[model samples]
Target chain A: MGELRLMKGNEVLAEAAIRCGCDGYFGYPITPQSEVMETLMARQPWEETGMVVLQAESEVAAINMIYGAAATGKKVMTSSSSPGISLMSEGISYIAGSELPCLIINVQRGGPGLGTIQPSQADYFQAVKGGGHGDYKLIVLAPSSVQEMNDFVDLAFELAFKYRNPAMILTDGAIGQMMEKVELADFKPRWTNDELIEKCGSWATTGKPAGRKPNIITSLEMDSAKMEANNKRFQEKYRKMEEEEPRYEALMCDDAEYVIVAFGTSSRVCQKAIELARAKGVKVGLLRPITLYPFPKKAIAELSCRIKGFLSVEMSAGQMIEDIKLSVFEGGCIVPVKFFGRLGGIIPSPGEVVKALEENFLKG
Target chain B: MDIKDIIKPENLVYKKSELLIDTIMHYCPGCSHGVVHKILSEVIDEMGIQEKTIGIAPVGCAVFAYNYIDIDWQEAAHGRAPAVATGVVRLNPDNIVFAYQGDGDLASIGTAEIIHACNRGENIVVIFINNGIYGMTGGQMAPTTLVGQVTSTTPAGRNVDLNGYPMKITELIAQLPGTSYVTRQSVQTAAAVRKCKRSIKKAFQNVIDKKGTSFVEVVSTCNAGWKMTPVGANKWMEENMFPFYPLGDMKDSDKKEVSNN
Candidate 1:
């Protein structure tokens, strides 16, 4: 087994990427997540692991670099915060529409603009829902701890290639900057680009020969009928993924009367709220989404029958709450729903969530 | 046979390798992209890195560079090849990485990426095409376009006061401590073509030897964008452009030391 070490989420992410033999990394320097680049640069990964690391001019260029490398079926990735992710939308859409498999990390910060340097999960809609244009979805994994940083690197690669889709780790500044002991896997899998070329060769631009079948890597579908067919294929694949990959962690939901809905750092906050609310003789429990896209609807919908209401507490301006509401009982049931959130990296204290839990569920 | 006559197929003189993308050329009849692509592809073939090489295309005429390169090709936003190339080279240092850009893409928009990459001493090859005009966006005043040169946007002529003087990217980058070699050559006539090829080879070699950022600026002509006959454009560059953007080694670390000794 590999040695255990205390590492920040960003550092763990950098190490995990190299350990997994990522083909390339493209990123610009920004606070909170700057440690990702600093860590890679400090390690001289190129010299050590023959890993590629580049400090791009802007987040826009960095994502496009990922776009360039990902086109070759090479395991590639990029990381940015909210504002930078906003700049990366166009390229993200292109990569998705191109049907390329790659990983993207967003150490989320506050904002609809350059919101704040502090941690925020306000990009929930952008991460889970489609932020960029086109009918495409990225498999979003939310890691609450540094240990998950190592596990998610392998998982993101697995899901990316498995679904021919882009995967994102929607972490935040708190997780990115926080240091924690992480368990590393012992097994090392050496990935070769040629193997990917052989597997993903049907469409990859790996230098097709003359007089052979011409291959095109484009999202541009000029023909209406062809586009319709492509969309149908995408929808079918998404449905299959949703069935196979619903991941989440639930606590005491079996006997609880009220469910607290959250993900990422906000979920961690709600966990504390759950503990306090229980001590105060309240029957509130927490539901944390690990995979935000294939949302944990099964457990949530089941709990809707037993619970009085669902408190959707988030770090964003009520983004994931919509998913929670839509997932459990849809619009039919008056299974009451309420939201509490703080935008632009200002997190609601567990006291706030506990207070809301008391006022909304316990009192009623 | 000097390893040149191993192939049995009579129609193909070289190895039966797919090192070039099979596609139609969108460049004008006399644009230098085709020639430069030929030379680059030849080098890629000779080096036997078809599977382990990646190329970044600029936003100019070569935006669809993925269409021409056989191995792996990525298109960068205009002037961002170095940034993209940095990402690729950093992730897989074993792979041969290069970025191709035109004047507008390199000297104008991508200036930050190239300069910072050089300053940081990134081991990537940057092939800058100085065609004296923005070929992809139609002819406009360029960083390399000389004073008094009339481009479409310039109308009557490029005014020094209004447009400022031409920019020398190679000379500027060569001064940086991070850059080991910065060369300026043209791909015009046969002799110039030889020099241009040499610079590219040298830049690739620098990357192989783990030298810092290797920059090669190739002065070329955009006949269509300049609204001149291909031959006239070549002549214009020779007479008017070459004086401002003088050809030859701007700075080479080893060459400088050798000459000093």
Candidate 2:
């Protein structure tokens, strides 16, 4: 087994980035996620793995840095919280438009405008529905535990480069701050310059050699027909991801009449709520969505055929519930899809979730 | 002699830089951007660094700079070219990186990005074109717009109370310790054009020597934005612009005696 150690979710993200052979990390410190850069700084990964870590002036600068580095065909990333992520939205859009591969981590905090420092999943709409302005989608991965935090780094980079699209780890303040045992992956050597040319030379902005045309990474297309074609190409990519990338976990769903749809910290709470409801003779199960963008719509559609209803529990004012409802509707099922959420960073307990499920889906 | 014989190789005294593509530029006639693009491409060719050079194209007229220069390039969002260059050069130290930006992009919307990238001593070259007005957006007033100069946004001429004074950002950049070389030059005359070319070449060499951020501010003219003929704009710039934004080497780490102007 790999080396196991107790670490905070944010810290494990840093360790995982280094162990996974990330070439560079550019970030601006924000609360609840500052440890991501702090841990990297303290470890001095440049000394060990030749990784370059820099504290950018702002989220705008950090995200643009990711754009530049990613254009050069390097594994680059950045991390921030809600407000910072908002600042990065424009740069993120540019990155998406340019079709560069990179990772962005948003350890979410409450916000309509700097709402609170505590955990909230309100950025769901922003993360999965093209956070930046464009006809594009980020491959959003929701991690519930510190272990998933450690695992998703490599996985996100893998998927990002595979599709030449941006990927994000949509975690929260709770998981970012909480300490848990994580098994760190082995040190993977960074791709050499020769390997980079072999893999990304087709499009990446590596310096042009003689006999080859210069590689220009840009999103601007003055021709309307060309721009529309690019947009269609992007939509095709998202559709491919939807078909091949949706990941979900269904617990006790085989025999359940009522299912609770949740993700991240909320999903963990639903697992406990499942046990509580089962003990009380209520047949409830949990359907946890791990990839929020390429959401488990098919799984929910299949479950909608037999399930009585779906109760989406979240830490925001009913965001994921919309997706669940859409799934049920797409499945052509006439089942009730309900939402239960605590807004402004309040996480619901198992008993509270069970009560919400019963009040929304049960009771004559 | 036949026309073909006159056009033979021996008769040709000069040719366009091979690094420049054959595509026609969209820049307006007499716009300094074309001249700057020509000189930059010539520098890359002369230095034989075309294969090891990367460029960051900023928003504005120069956004299509990658189309003209035959080198690897990443087009940056408005005013964020410096930060993008930081990322490119830091990861690939062996590659020479440079950012091309206009006044509105560098001095206004992207102020934070430019200042911080310079302060961090990123090993890259910055080609800052200051024409004192936003040319691509129909001559809007820029942060570098001179006081009492009339722009589309300032039809009654810029006022000190409402619009603030013109910013000398090159002077500010020179003060940053992280910067190894800072110079302000123009391309209005043949002699000035030669001097500007030398300055650009020097900036690129600094990157090779591992010197920190090298900034070259080209005091340029936007004839259409200025609402004047090409010849009139040149005369106007020499008379008014030269006083405030003087042409000289402001700072150089290699020389102990640094000139303020």
Q: Highest DockQ: which candidate?
A: 2
C-alpha RMSD of each candidate structure in angstroms: 5.4, 1.0
Q: Over the stretch A237-282, how does candidate 1's per-residue lDDT look in tens digits?
A: 7888788998999987777888998887888888888898888888
Give lDDT tens digits, candidate 2, residues A232-303. Answer: 999999999999999988999999999999999999999999999999999999999999999999999999
- CA-RMSD of model 2: 1.0
lDDT of each: 0.80, 0.95
Give the TM-score of each candidate: 0.82, 0.99
Label model 1 with its docking quality class: acceptable
Q: How well does candidate 1 score on lDDT at residue A94?
A: 77
| lDDT over C-alpha atoms for residue B118 of model 2 | 91
**What local lDDT does model 1 show for residue A316?**
77
Error of 1 at B66 (Å): 3.1
lDDT (0-100) at residue A322 of candidate 1? 80
